[model samples]
Target chain A: MTKISAEGICKSFAGPRQRVEAVRSFSLDVREGEFVCLVGPSGCGKSTFLRIVAGLMEATSGRLEIHRDAEDGRPLNSMVFQEYAVFPWKTVSENVAFGLAMRNVPRKERDARTAEWIDRVGLRRFAHHYPHQLSGGMRQRVGIARALANDPEILLMDEPLGALDAQTRTVLQEELLRIWQSRRKTVMYVTHSIEEAVLLGDRVVLMTAHPGTNKAEFTVPLERPRTLQTTTDPQFSRLSYQIWEELRDEVQRSMEENA
Target chain B: MSSGGQRNRTREEDGKAHTGAGLMSPAAGTVLLRWVALFVLFNGAMTVLRLWEPLWWAAALVNFVLLVRIAEQGALLVPARFARTYERSLAVAFPLVLLAGWQLVVGAEILSPTWFPPPTRIVRALWELATGFDEFTGTSLFGRPWEIPARLAEDGLKDGAAAFTAESHLFATLMRVFAGFAIGAVPGVLLGMVMGVSRTVRAMVDATLSAFYVLPKIAIFPIMMLVFPNPFGEGPKIAVVAISAFFLVAINTMVGVRDIEPVYLEAGRNYGATGRRMFRHVIIPAALPVIFGGLRIALGTALIVIIAIEFVRSRTGVGYLTFYYWEILSPDKMYAGLVVVMILGVGLTTGLKALERVVMPWRRDPGRSDPGG
Candidate 1:
């Protein structure tokens, strides 16, 4: 079933000197329970597009929709931000329970679900600790747990592991795959890393730089239950390299535009 | 093997030479002797130049430098294990040295005792102020706390309350500070929050608020007096304090709220926090650290404004006591009043710090491992 559909979506910002187009005529169709990764160069508006889908930002012009089941009481989408936007004031359990608390979920259910997610993220020991007390990787875990605990129809991630160290990133990637395998939610993951996209997503959608638009798409032929060891697979390397070839030109173009 | 043995012998000789050189370097004993000689030389020069007033000050300046050098050397001589204690002691000792110098200068009649009374005299004056009631002003510094129980027993609640009334300078000042702080801070924070959240409100009031903020709060005392129904009452004085505190807190709170990370707000909105929920879960908690910062600044401003107002208008406050003592040419009493004000400032700031800790437990130093963790 088609869960998310975007047709010719455009977003522009009014700059100090001129109107800057960020995303132009971006289009994608995401299937239910399918992990779709949007890979692009810097300033490609991949994050902006994700924000639009999350309802945090508005598209200038387009038909963008997340088809919801009338019976489902969960939120349409919950975002895991690039910066690990966990509340510094709240403990891990509280941050995980934030969405449920906002929805006025009962105390018993909220605590149970929050505890469950905290354990899922391997943050059970730090459940009572604030975001500032946690490391970058742990903080991102809280962010992921928060989105998952919300039980949203679709999980929107914007470079969720982008700020972490290489080892931390790899560990989280495995954890993410493990979590997703258990509860397969529709996800739109935006990343700059081709390998991450190939490793995580069932389909990788490449975007052009500077006023981003869809350029190419590649279906990941890798098997599920993927691990860090999967990156060593010959097909994984070949697919990552192929995506890099398409993305290198756009990365160069972006650097020039920025200059 | 012979060449290696020679190299090892040279290395041993080098280590011995290094240790010998270290031993020759100015040890603590040498430093102490040097400091002692300098101290005596400076003191002797100071004694000789004491007859000449201009040269005496120059000698005193030289002596002061020597004293500081001695203190630094003394600190270095302290063992590493007692470093923290030594540091604290140095802080206390420096002030004591200043006080001793003050005593000597005044005692020797280098400075007039009447105008620059020694610290001993100030302590005596403070004790008198605390203990004795002034017949002339019909007031005291702390009121008769010892008489409170007796008065309550004899006169009951109505007259017993007199013991706690604003007859004491300290009590009056405290009441004004607390009352004005609450009056100003509450509305200031609320208005600041409103202005922070709404750009229209911010634009509307920001300019006028800034104008009022920069205008010296003391300059508006007369205006506040005129605004109040009774110009001579506590109302005008408290109002002036409130106005000063209001501007500081409001501006700071607004900045605090506005400075909240946009990403947090986005996350809040995305996670279904709206209206009051948004405020409680996101905005207020996020802005709390800054709000406390504003409150702390506002509190300090409130104290300053109140003290200044009391100096001009109040008959029963620490400021009034200080100024009155000056008018009476009682420098000791005036110094005592200043001491009280300093104590009050420290006490209030400490209280605010405690409150800040309680309000924002999340901001505690991350170095301290949490009990839960």
Candidate 2:
């Protein structure tokens, strides 16, 4: 079953001097329970495309649809922002339970689900602590737990681990794989890291620089239940390097254009 | 303090070889010589201070300047044991030194006692005013907190509260600040929210709001009086304070709303939050830090406006007491009233800070200085 279908979606911003095209003719069809990674350099509008799918932004011209898959009437999609957009004013459990509260879930049920997600994120100890009290990695965990607790049909992540340190990023990547393997919600993950793209995505969708068009797609041949040790596998490095080879030019082009 | 002593010990050890080589090296020896000269000048000034001559005053002035310069350099050289407490030590020390200087100058009769009564005289007057009720004016400095129970016993709770309020200038000022702040802040926040969310409303009111914001609130007092049925009643006085608080809160709340990160709003919308839910869970909480910041400023403004109003037109309040003392040529009592105002300001501010802690529990660290906290 197709979870999300996007055809010729475009996004443009009006600048003081000219109309800047952020994303142009972007198209993708994501399958239910499939993990798809949109890989690109900075300013490539992979995030913009994700926002469009999440209905946070409107596509200039296209047909975009998200199939509602939850029997319990959950939201269509929930996005984990790149900046760990957890409310600094709310406790960890409160942030996790926010969507449930908004959905008018009962107090007992909301607390139960919130507690469950908090434990899953390994933030049970810091459940009553505010976002400001948590580290960057822990705060991002709260952001992830928040989206997951919402019980959305599709999980849209925009570089969720992008701000974290390399060591923390690897740990979270394993945690993410562990959670996704168990739940298998339709996921559209946007990132600039090719290694991350190959390590996580069942299908890696490469985006170009300048106007952010669909450049290429690589289907990962790696099996599920991937771990930190999986990155050391010869196949993993080979896939990562191959994708890097494809992405190297666009990365250089973006840097040059920015310069 | 320990670090300062340690630094001094290290300096002494390091400078042992460099001592008494003043003209040759012009380094540590020169600093030592400068300190010696500073001490000599200070002692010389102290000797001159005993003289009853105008020429000695010039020498004293020069000595004071030299002492100030050396003290500034000495402060720079001393290392702090506890950074926060060390800085606060200077704040405490400067005021104490100023008070001592005032005491000396007035005691020595260099300044007239009528014009500038010494700190001791002010404290004494403050104590007398606090303890004794004036039969002529029917007021006491503090409403005599010690006598509150006795008054309550004699007059029942209702009359006791009224009597206590009537007797206390500080209480009167505080009541005005609280009433006016509430009257203004609630509507100010509402209007600000409306303006923040709607472009049409913002465009319409922005100019007029800015104009009113710039206008001195005191200038509108006559108009406030006209609007109220009784000009000399509490209504006009409160109206002036409310107007001042209103402009400050409205402007600050508007800015707070406008400054909220769009990402949070987007996230809120994505998670199925709409209308009241969005305002409660997202918008209001997001803007709270800024709104509280505005409230703090509004609080200070309310105190200032209320005091000014009291000075011009009221029979009660700390401001009126100060002006009344001034009218009767009692500078010490006037100083006591000024002290009362400071105490009230501090007390109100502390209350606001406590309220902030309750409202904003997520701000774990009270001070914003420590990013790591």
Q: What is the C-alpha lDDT of each candidate?
A: 0.89, 0.86
Q: Which one is best on TM-score?
A: 1
Q: Candidate 2 on A38-94: residue-level lDDT in tens?
A: 999999999999999988888988889878756787888899999769998898998
lDDT at B236, model 2? 94
The sequence of per-residue lDDT tens digits that candidate 1 reaches over residues B51-166 is: 53546566667778778767666755566699899889888887898889889878888888989999999999999999999988788998878878887898799877775575
Q: DockQ of candidates 1 onward, in order?
A: 0.49, 0.46
* Model 1: chain B TM-score relative to the native chain B: 0.86
Tell me the deviation in Å of residue B117 in model 2. Answer: 0.9
Best by lDDT: 1
TM-score per candidate, in order?
Answer: 0.91, 0.88
- For model 2, name the residue pairs that clash: none
Worst 10 residues of 1 chain B by lDDT: B364-373
lDDT score for candidate 2 against the true structure: 0.86
Candidate 1 to native Cα RMSD, angstroms: 5.9
- Lowest lDDT 10-residue stretch of candidate 2 chain A: A65-74
